[model samples]
Target: MKGKYVEAKERLRGSIAPLVTPFKRNYEIDLDKQRELIEFQITNGTHGISVTGTSGEPSSLTVDERITVMENAVKTIDGRVPFVPGTGSVNQAETLHLTKVAQEMGADAAMVIVPYYNKPNQQALYNHFKTVADSVDLPIIVYNIPGRTGVNLEVNTLARLVEDCPNIIGVKESNKDFEHVNRVLLYCGRDFLLYSGIELLCYPMLAIGGAGSISATANVEPKKVAEMHNAWESGNLEKAQNLHFELMKLNDVLFKDTNPAPVKAALGMMGKIEPVLRPPMGLPSKEVLKEIHQTLIEYGKDVQNTFDM
Candidate 1:
């Protein structure tokens, strides 16, 4: 229907990450820590970082802080790996504003999630995604996680949007429904990138010709995830399976809390960054802290001074 959002999308059929935002004990955006995390991911072999994603906790950030985080990440990356920003707002107008900001700041693309609370139907979902895609020249990857959004993106609705909105390049499906993933892949063909939004299920998704993943676990073990993907791609199924177990265990830890809580704590334990969180999402409890430390130590990771149960 228009020029090619497809071209930009081709570069991203590989592994990407939904980065964990680093915060200080004082609850400020630690730019240095953010830089380290991006560099760590890129250096450890991640393809890209989906900044400000649900995993990145956009709800905890202000409008200006979100923009600041985007600008900071763009500056730190300096044109190495591609960048994706989750600019979804509860309101359509606010979402558009953030999407434009992302495009203007030179981000490669934007991921707008389904409108929460309002719980739009298929037509509204189509229009919502198409509207954002039409608003920006950059490619758009719609996020469909009904568990978080409270509204599933039906296959027909996604099909309609991909047919009508050329700029809608792909989706991050966290629904954990293989039937839905199957439908999207079958109808959308190899032209669209379908990333498994579920980290533990990445190998199965890739087995089905799906694209890569956008994982929170990658925040801590980028190399582990990359190695797992590389092994699977190289036909080393056994190695991939073993690596998958490692990721699954770690992901179990991450999801133990609301999110970012366990992961952020793990980062702190490794002495990679401080473990701090905004309100409503605070530092892990002593019980959670004990489990996190014990798990890390069990995984043979360092759990010295930075982390205590």
Candidate 2:
């Protein structure tokens, strides 16, 4: 198990795109488009693929929908790159079941978010994560997005979880608190695979020993996002920095509204998906949409001619 984990750790680092779950106009899971999206990521040089994550809108999906997405993601990925599915749900039983399903489907790792809405205390959080980790042999990457989750996984809590669960290997820090993340690496040790979930922090995180980003921007700019990491890894710091600066506008614009809305709109403009989001999470307004479209043009996405497609 240790040897297997060592191999996973090595392969799991890079631009792991947390894919937007493409939906049909009727809001059904478009499995065909899902497969296409995976293929697009692979062909465009995304280092890894994750499904049913924040960008994939797992909260909006039924348990069966999430599992179906994972199953398809596993088959479509087909060992080309590491597959990390967001298996954590607000419900403990559901988190366990989805994580176990991910394990059964041969996922390289499972990304479980800190439980949201209920806002459990740190001890409860630790207990929840430890239970999931113990239940599966799959490596776990804890997702910490306090903005969305309504609770912070304190540095001590993360440290404790790491000490207790050998399979809990990393964290995707969507936090904006720069000092907090620094302390995480400081206390948790540099070997911890810290990934930046915040778009603007992707390059900065790499500078601070982050594994890579599970960035939403990668949904639109897979090649460049992957190149940023590849450049950094290959000792081309200047190229990496340049790409970071170049990607800044698109990164900022995508989050101007909510997540996958802007992302789906951008992809739709590029003729990737239908830009359909499930109800209650609708498309961005015309103003935000215009800004997104303009930004994509500035970033050379060739979306000008494809918006209506």
Model number with the top TM-score: 2
Which tens-of-lDDT digit does each residue in 7-116 have in candidate 2?
Answer: 87788999999999999999999999999999999999999999999999999999999999999999998999889999999999999999999999899999999999
Q: Tens-digit lDDT track for model 1 on 1-309? A: 455565676677667888777888888889899998899898999988788888788888988888888999999899898899889988888899999999999988898888887898888888888888888888888899899889999988898888887888888998788989989988876668898888877888888887788878888778888888788878899998898887787778777887778888888888888887788887778887788787778778877544545
Off by over 4 Å in 2: 304-309
- In model 1, the worst 10-residue window by lDDT is 300-309
Estimate candidate 2's alpha-carbon lDDT, on a 0 to 1 scale. Answer: 0.92
Query: How many clashes in each candidate?
Result: 0, 0
TM-score, one value per model: 0.94, 0.97
Off by over 4 Å in 1: 1-4, 305-308
